[model samples]
Target: MYRFSYSEILEDAPQLARERERMAFDRALHLLRTVEARGERGAERTAAIAFVQDLWNVLLSDLLDPENALPEALRSDLVSIGAWTMGEVGEALRAPERSLAALIEVNTSIRDGLQ
Candidate 1:
């Protein structure tokens, strides 16, 4: 059996949350990159796109929540970044010539920032 102290339980809660977030972003980035390498593989592209969309939607919702602990200005900026990410994803999907590099770059940046 294992035991924990109250102080330990209370500390670094957000670090755990951030680690989860970082992993999700990494997974999403991997999916997107795979789709990019596969070119026109329909199912992979669809899955990757849906994953990115869902991830961003969840993030946006959390940012918008009144109980969210992030600073007001920082949350606002993150919301804007999320909006741009969604926009770029939509645009890339709509245009055959458009590339997913922007999506990859932005996701990488966000994931790195979580450190």
Candidate 2:
């Protein structure tokens, strides 16, 4: 077995974390598009809403934590973006002929940026 250096360990953890985050966004994006195509009355809508809500909830909690490594300004901006995203989720449910374009767009942007 090979031993890992401390710097490698640190670098590896964040890279892994970013990949996980990217995958989570990927899942959410897929669900959102499925919901769009299938209509909001189906199981797909239920799943998409649940996944997006849960994903953002976890991210917001992390960003709000005082010990979070992200800079304060960046964290604050993300929190604001999350708030908007959550509002869109609510609207997507409550409005007739609701379009998930905003949700899809924002999540796609963030997912692409995770690289």
Candidate 3:
């Protein structure tokens, strides 16, 4: 087995960040779709929303941090999007039948922006 060092991974921060964002969105999309299809409304749905919320929290934290390297305008845009996402998640949970198109579109837009 080949092991990658933590430092080595951090060396490619841009690529890693993009990949992570894409993966997070994909996971969120899968979870949302599953819940929408089966109406399970169980642990999986909770976990899915949690995952998305967690992603936004990280983005918000980075945007708020003064030490972060991202430009002010870009950070502001991300924060706005993150806030909107949280609101959408709340609405989705309340009405499981409501379409997830908004959330999906937002995730796709963000993922594409990261590319």
Which is superior by lDDT, 1 or 3?
1
- Model 2 misses residue 34 by how many Å? 1.4
Tens-digit per-residue lDDT, 1-115, candidate 1: 8864322432557677778789999999999998898785476787898899999998898888776677899999999999999898788767755678889998999999999
TM-score of 2: 0.84
Q: After superposition, how far is residue 32 of candidate 2 from its true place, in Å?
A: 0.6
Q: Which candidate achieves the best TM-score against the true structure? A: 2
Clash count for candidate 2 is 0
Q: Please give, for residues 1-115, the per-residue lDDT of candidate 2 as tens digits.
A: 9975333443569887788889999999999888787776766686788799999988887778666767788889899999998888888767637888889999999899889
TM-score of each: 0.84, 0.84, 0.76
Lowest summed lDDT across 10 adjacent residues in model 2 is found at 3-12
**Which 10 residues in a row give candidate 1 its minimum summed lDDT?**
3-12
lDDT (Cα, tens digit) per residue for candidate 3, span 1-115: 9975433443568688668767877887787667667766667777777778887877677678776667788988888998999999888778756676788788878877777
Candidate 3, which ten residues in sequence have the lowest lDDT sum?
3-12
In model 1, the runs with Cα more than 4 Å from the true position are: 1-12
Q: If ranked by TM-score, best first, what sequence of candidates would result?
A: 2, 1, 3
